[model samples]
Target chain A: MLHEPATPVGKDLAATYKMRLGVLMFLFYSLFYAGFVAINLLNPLLMEVTILPGLNLATVYGFALILVALIEALAYDLFCRRKEQTLNNTQNTQGEGN
Target chain B: MTIIIFLFFVLLVIGLSLYLGKKAKTSSGYYAAGGKIHWGVNGIAFAGDYLSAASFLGICGMIATVGYDGFLYSIGYLAGWIVALFVVAEPLKRLGKYTFTDAIDSKYNSRGIKLAAAISTLVVSVCYLIPQMVGAGVLVEPLLGIPHGWGVVMVGAIVITIVATAGMTSTTYVQFLKGGLLILFSTVLVVAVCVRGLTTQPDQGGNVPYYEYTTLAAVNESGQIKVSDAGWQVVELQDIESAKLTFAKLAKDGKETWWLVSEKDGAVELHETQSVVTTRDGQRLINGAPASQDNQLRQVSNIEKLRGASDASTGSVSPIELLAAVSDKDTQINLWKEAALTDKDGGKVTIYYQKVTPGNQVMRPGLKFKVQGTPLERADFLSLMLALFLGTAALPHILIRYYTVPNPASARKSTIVAIAAIGFFYILTLFMGLGAMINGVLNPADSNMAAPLLARSFGNILFAVISAIAFATVLGTVSGLIVAASGAVAHDLLDRFLNLRMDDHQKVRAGKISAFVIGGLAIVLGILYKGMNVTFLVGLAFAVAASANLPSIVMLLFWKKTTAKGITASIIMGIVSSLVLILLSPDLFKLYGLDPATAPIPLSNPGIVSIPLSFCTLVVVSLLTGEKAKALKLAAQQ
Candidate 1:
């Protein structure tokens, strides 16, 4: 008991904001991915239906999972930076509050 | 030409690594690139490190062989990064100094945590390494006209040099370059496939040109099979009663092969113009002849009939048009299947036979994973998806990459970039695999050769370029793995757990030594697991990582009452349970030359069970130890 049990401080002013947003985006993407897997498991025949010209549900859904991950990642990054900027600006306006 | 390109790439990586090695004198420099890597560069490097031979070779080969089931891997692998970007990247960067163990053990600094995490890292890395080493050998066979053992050793040597010299810095650059070139060349190859469009006859002007299977009419009178064609004769025939399907074993010209048996208007039809038979006496037989340039497994995949096309080929079409053409009901494509049986003389015979499948069927599921087959089969598919979706963030090599970036934001930025690059590359895998499926370039015995061989179908130069990138893909990934493994050994096991009190200089030296040892071990294991499928091996690695590390990482970050003992115990449980379950699973049972039906566990993938087991273990242990830990913490604070 001579030393402090090093506890992980995973939350901070910005970290709390980031983690909340990150989990939300992650859950949204997770559901989208799960839906793709669910369709394959439950009704694989549905994957055969043509959803676009020259494209079926299987190919379209597969591509969408990948594209959505990319879009979500970019969007997540943009949102985090904007929110962090506001946090920094607010803290600066009320200097030495802590 | 392949050898020249391959050598140039290898030498360039080594030369650059040696140049960068001078700057990597400190522990941070060697292990985490001194936390100075640019987000843009690190992003592609992430792709380079992540997209191993499994992504390029195995997935393409799977798609070429099994269709849409292969793209499912692409989906799961890319989806896993969402967890990394959102949950792991920033937090891991803020906490860890070097190694995945560092991040997980940052709060506890317990010997138990160090030991468990370090062992898990080694297990996952070695599992991931076997496939890369095997893929390196597979790629090198065509590159240097060599056997697999030497190719594995050569790759090991190259990757070791990359790791031993410049460390993470050199590895990052190599990965970045490989990642960029791999994407660029794949796009080029995909465009070429689109431009070439749907062709009934592929390998247009090759020495061994592709032709559709010739179905011969025969009268099955008792045991004698009399064929209408004079050149090809079925000397002896025996019907196979398996899977409720009809197949006949035929012996002709001292070679054995399997034929699809069907009756048209009462006359038995023997289909398949080509089949490769590997005999008991170590002879490779193709179409009842010794395997040679002239006599080989006929270029396997080709369109028997193009869908809605008026000509012999659908002249230059768009990528969408290509997919549409392949997805048509009228489109008939040639695919291959393997069958095995005991010969008349008691020797085991393996035969690869051609099958005619509708384009619509070839583009859908039910080929590989069997999603709708049975409850267990569906569970296996779901387990694999869960592992892949969770495994990316849990992998030690991936976690360590966050340490290479300067800040948490940089880590997040790099991961987003990795998602874009890797997602684009995975989409191209579908195009490349579809092209290979119809282009008649896939090796009958090895689906892993699909992408490089598909590039070969385009032209020799593209093949050479793609082959070089594949080799570099192996190198980049293997180096990253070695770096992770070395950090675990030198930093976690020796320095942290063993309390060796190694200085920064001593630690870097020990890390280099560990890299050499791991490289040597990898080469030996690669040679041992020579015939294993790369994708399957990588999947097992993912399962282990997900089961072992993900729970501990997630709970440690989220749960307020999580203790060191809880983290340590769960990691061991995860590793042991997953390994045991994998050992008893049907897939490994089949690999062991035993009846898969005899496997104790029905599930081939254990993530569905083992991951939850790990989480339960963590929660139980944490609750049991919460009071003592709380008292100790309170005492220390007071």
Candidate 2:
């Protein structure tokens, strides 16, 4: 595909970076979610233990999943922004040299 | 008063639709809101569209009845948006102009791809529509004093008006309005739950049961209901026309009692209630009053504090304390347990009994999805979860929302906003459900009514507001689905495949006509599926979408070698396989008034099998065709 030259150069750059980060976050989140489900399947008794005052492990784990989603969203946005900035800086420098 | 508020909300929404309709002269405006919606509003609208009856009414009811199992749905639904935000939102917006099918057909204007994708969209959208319509019917009976069928028809008419008038623009605003109000009012209800706190306090104001029963000696026209001290004589009966099953009042020694009668062979038998009474109107009341809105039980029952902390019933604990207290093993909480009882007619009627469950057990996962059940049952549970987690990003209606934004970045931003709003709302459901459980406000017949009934426990005013908001929730979701289905029909099927060569005006007109047809279809299905749990129906839709649509969409975005033929084949495989599996699944058999055990398919959800099947179809076909064919097709299109 690269030799064919049909694809844009920067398109792969952003796509690669985004895909890598996105897959990583997705896998990481899935592991946590799977853990919750696995625990429910394997030994549901663990969910009964109070991890905090007035809160059980199951409830805490559920809320933690939501927090993790928010954090991942923010992290992805920042990472993409930085990548775009780097790409723009290189283009500017090349233009100046020309 | 409730009716007045409901009327106001309905009129306001209809008026807004007509106002927005003026701008929908063009197909772009009608289909994608002219790609002019603000990212912020669109994000909230996404939440509105996604929440539906399942998230608001279904999850809460599940939690109220079963405990921690319901929150799992919230987690699965929200996790799916992460896929949308990180992977799908930007790419879909960049690719498609109006509809989700456009994103795929953009590469090659293949009529096969258009036809297959359009059919899948319609199937998934209609499956999704059934639950929303069912939820509307559930709300109508209790809130508007109307029959369930009328409520479904009312929703269909309103949704058609909205979709046919202004299309996406009207849908978006209605979604945005309802979404914001749903979150706001839910927070109010959650706070009220917190203020009221956990209580083991028995209902004193309403008709209180004087005795509890383990069993009855006999039941007939002259059958006797056994009490601890003495027995009662059978009186008038209801629902026993065939002399199979009935509710009756028994008068014994100047005191009256309620008994459930079961007739077997030539003999009549009686089952005594745990707590029951006979009202002046000869109505058999359980606990205190009949299981109607007139019941005054307004607080959580069968409660206790942490095991070692105190044996006494803790009164008015804080919200956090309430949850923590329920997690303790010693805390005796009341939860509903359902059992299917065989009536005299040999049919099954599922009856829910109030059980004194330990808090530790309630907080655990085994109550609903029992691991101890058959292997197939356990597999079905996992399949349901997988579908829910994958379905959100694949939904035709959700995908179209991305095109409503200006750019890929806006699409990404709006999705994140959706996650935040939706996540917050799901958390509130736990409290609302728990509140409903303790408050004795649940309608024993319909789990869908738990959230609204919880509000009614606060007062009629709050009930009116929540019910109206819930009605809007159904309307917004149903309208969005109808619009998506109509687009698939008009734009993808007619214009692209049939080569109708429709102008913008003709396209909009065709779409509107399609909306009316699909809306009517949804209304009919909803009435047919009455009394079924709304949330479970949604689970089926998710499974279908995950199986049929997700594989093709994901492969198209990622794999360069994915041919139009591969895409077409995969979609057909996905749709056909999932539909066949679902039709053969036990649950559908149960719906058809057949024995569930006789169904060939073991798993209820088709995602675990059909999703992988669809993926393999896409890959195998792509590999067989090789990349050269795709390259030639692309060149030809250019």
For each candidate, give the interface RMSD after superposing the true interface residues on Cα: 6.2, 7.8
- Per-residue lDDT of B531 in model 2: 85
Interface RMSD against the true structure, candidate 2 = 7.8
lDDT per residue as tens, model 2, B1-638: 98999999999999999999998899889999988888899999999999999999999999888888887888888888887887787777767876778887777678888899999999999999989999999999979889999999999999999999999999999999999999999999988877766555534223343123344556233443333335555554445443244555566766544456656685565654433334345565444346575753323334533464433545566778878766778777666544443333332334344556888888767778775467776777788778988899899999999878765656777888899999999989888887777666666566788899888877788999999999999999999999999999998888888989899899999999999999999999999988888888888888889888888888988898888888999999999999999999988898897888899998888988999999999999888776667578999999
Best by TM-score: 1
Candidate 1 per-residue lDDT, tens place, A39-86, comes to 989998888888899788888888889988999998888888877666
Among all candidates shown, the one with the greatest lDDT: 1
DockQ for each numbered candidate: 0.36, 0.27
lDDT of 2: 0.79
- Which residue pairs of candidate 1 clash? none
Those runs of model 1 whose alpha carbons end farther than 4 Å from true positions after fitting are A1-12, A89-98, B205-208, B222-225, B228-233, B238-240, B245-258, B278-282, B308-311, B628-638
- Which pairs, if any, clash in model 2? A54-B324, B207-B288, B219-B269, B219-B270, B299-B438, B300-B438
**Against the true structure, what is each candidate's TM-score?**
0.94, 0.86
lDDT tens readout by residue for model 1, B345-434: 544556566777887777777788888799889988999999999999999999899888766777888998899999999999999998
